[model samples]
Target: MSDGDPADDIMTATYRALCTHGYADLTMQDIADESSKSKAALHYHYDSKHDLLCAFLEYLYDRFVERTSDPAGADPAAQLRSLVQTVLDKPEDDREAFETAVLEIRAQAPYEPGFRERLTRFDDYLAGEFERLLEAGIDDGVVDPAVDPADTATFLVTMLTGAATERVTAGRSVECTRRMLAEYVESHLLTDATEAQL
Candidate 1:
């Protein structure tokens, strides 16, 4: 664990710097300076900017998993809402960093096998999680039985991505996304019978 600490610290520092500086302006020296670690030390762990970025993505996913798994007692819809809200409500500085990193990695993913794999894994995991939640919602009668789990999951994930993109690019706040999603659930997922019960 002690050995892992520095690497974690480096990843955290790198993420913060990326969020603040964005990908175009980000540099190894910036990471080193922000992290307060020697350039040699940073190099000792990651050989290149790409490697560090890949690690950063991994770190973010790990955090995402932990956050999702920690809370219990809520139904699937509530859990999903919580997940979206968590992402939406992330500290602005951190959100900017994450967006910058993802955009940078996405741009280079075509040429980098490892980065592409990491990106694919992240997307797959998110989609899978949504599928599970949709299934649960169906079982609980909270979601429409006729809704295709895979298709609905894909749609919800797409909506989330669009909302996040808007938040990042158009200066839109998450409240807009939240309102839209709530309306979407009420209109599409919850049946008239269920609506009457609520």
Candidate 2:
């Protein structure tokens, strides 16, 4: 939907409702309540809850892509930091609730081809971004040439998603996880040679 479209408004409302009521308890009425419009207006845009949810999923995916799309320049370490910060820098309560809702949607991916496709694409997009930064770092001699960019990218993505999942499921502190990731980057991804040069 276009930026100013009613569908967009409905979808935004759906996000708020999901954050508040969650996927299991989310209703059209609840979504409408969160929006600036009425239930009838929401129904006018979305024929069914499933239809609206699919649109909501698309909106979320697009937002994620937008957030993670570009690294800005040739600084791979900075690129990595930006990506990690974007994921973990949310305010505490909001971040937890948002992660919980996303996990709920993520668990449905297997049963829903639409979800599975979007999630898979998003994963690949992230992995590719990691690979790009790693390769750049190697080329710049900051990352060890011995490290395989492809393999390291995979590991990085796993670490990222794992940290996020841990926060959601176990209520782990975001700052703690963020520090661990930063340390992991320092110890593994950035070489002693790189540090010495710095």
Candidate 3:
């Protein structure tokens, strides 16, 4: 069953094919063919399509985390902007597949404890990063002292996620959405005092 440990290659191929063909249309046979592995071999690593999809989500999460590491010595506002820009900059082709994967599993999340837990971890990671940036901004006088860092961070991340989801689902122009989101943060999150300091 273990042949050269080709699971990594198989999963990568599966991800690319799923992104291209979508989850509803994707099949284990298609994945096997794409990965240059036999159907049995594919199943040896992933018992079912559901398992593969879950693994794919984990892969995407890992990639996202790796790509969004905090930049040392960056200003809080700048860090926050970078995070927002990263979310908006997700490739359109991948965006559709990613969104589809999330929506597909969302219903099953309640039944699948692992899925629910992983989702919570991912969400917490995002919120925590945003909160860190907000706290830094407050400390540096780039954000209003009166603003609650936790609330503002959660709001900003939620807003960005909603915008990204719209861009993925509505076929809206990413550039337009990016500009709109940036303008939104600047106008809403940055207070008069912060703007004056900038």
Candidate 4:
């Protein structure tokens, strides 16, 4: 669905409702309450809550791609930092609740093939981005040539996913995780010259 359309409105409402009520407690009525639409209208678009939530997952994936399509930095290190920040940056409203809801959705991925597929796509996308950046950095002599782009990308994605999950599940500090990631970049990814510069 395109922006400003009825379907887009439904997605937006779903996001708000999910953030407020979370996955388990979210209802079509709650989603409709966030939008100008009624519960009947929501049902008209989505036959059931399951269908609506699946659509919402697609919306979130699209938004994530759009958000990170452009990595904003002069160098690979800076670009990597920016990408990670975009993922970890807290929402202005319902910050904790939003993260908790995301975690709840992720927990359901294993049992739900649709959810698992969509979530895997997200990880693959991020890993591919990381791979590109790492390859570029190596070519430019900014990153260690010994670093395997594929393996490093997988490590980075796993680390980032863990950091996001930890923030809500274990009261871990995102700032602390950010610093740790920075350290990983400097100590492992960067070339000797780049590491010395930092």
Among all windows of 10 consecutive residues in model 2, the one with the lowest summed lDDT is: 189-198
Candidates 3 and 4, the one with greater lDDT: 4
Ranking by TM-score: 4, 1, 2, 3
Per-prediction TM-score: 0.82, 0.81, 0.78, 0.89
Best by TM-score: 4
| Higher-scoring candidate on TM-score, 2 or 3 | 2
How many clashing pairs in candidate 4? 0
Tens-digit lDDT string for candidate 1 (2-82)? 135877779878877787788777888888887869888888989988788888878877876766553343576666566
RMSD of each: 3.5, 3.5, 4.3, 2.6
Winner on lDDT between 1 and 2 is: 2
| Model 2, residue pairs in steric clash | none
Model 4, 1-198: lDDT tens digits are 337988888887887888789999998999999998999988998899888888888888887898887778888877776787777676344368777887898999989887888889999999999999999989988888999999999998998899888889998888887877777887888774243221
Question: How displaced is residue 192 in candidate 1, in Å?
Answer: 6.4
Candidate 2 lDDT (Cα, whole model)?
A: 0.75
Better of 1 and 4 by lDDT: 4
Evaluated with lDDT, which candidate comes out highest? Answer: 4
